[model samples]
Target: VVKYGKWLVAAGAVGMNVLAARDHNRAEDVFGALEARCSDDPRLCDLGDGGAYLDPGTEALYQQSVGYDRRARRWLIGGETALLGAAAMFVWELTRKTHRPDNIPFEPEVRSLRNATGVGLRLSF
Candidate 1:
């Protein structure tokens, strides 16, 4: 998860998905999925033909995500708040570097708790 966050930060800083994902595995996963689908026998399922569509879509989406990550770096969390948090973390780390204290970034907190409420949607036949 921390690795993902770091990747997102790089993407945000670089401001280009094609450039950012140049070092990311998301594109590899896209290609692997497309390859698997293309290689599958038609008797089993029809997959190869639509894969081209997915490729462009995946590229577009990855590019967009890169842009999003880049923009996230500009998040204006109150400087005072962030400074206080960083200060607290510095002191806390003095005690235990790996200790999880509280209010960790990206972990669910008050406002984000709304997102933790309703489950994600899924489709099933």
Candidate 2:
């Protein structure tokens, strides 16, 4: 059960990371577009009081870029959390003790015959 939980957590981490990567890519694309627009229109680059006043179209693009950037950050945080969960599960598994039936013991034997010689393991329950 712990093994399965570890696998599930690992898979979730991978999935979250994939989503984060996708969102990050989208954010980069939007940022590029925003830069291009600012370059084409010097007025869009003007910043007063720490914020530039933008036209409706430019404002829409800026909002879109902000949204993507925010989403990417959220996905990245989720991915990191999932990764930590997976690591914890791995540590738990490593620290766990193996349980075997007390009545069963491993017995190793050496066998010899006219034409063959081999080693065998015997277990009795």
Q: Which tens-of-lDDT digit does each residue in 15-124 have in candidate 2?
A: 88888888878878887887898889878766557574446667777778788878878888888898898899899989989796577588789989789998899987
Please report how far candidate 2 places residue 95 from its true position, in Å.
Answer: 1.1
**By TM-score, how accurate is candidate 1?**
0.21
Cα lDDT, model 2, residue 107 = 76
Superposed on all Cα atoms, model 2 deviates from the true structure by an RMSD in Å of 5.1
Per-residue accuracy of model 1 over 4-85 as CA lDDT, tens digit each: 4444444444444344444345445545554565466323223256442334544454455555444433342233344455
Query: Where in model 2 is the C-alpha error above 4 Å?
Result: 48-50, 101-125
Worst 10 residues of 1 by lDDT: 72-81
RMSD after CA superposition, every candidate = 22.4, 5.1
Model 2 compared with the native: what TM-score? 0.73
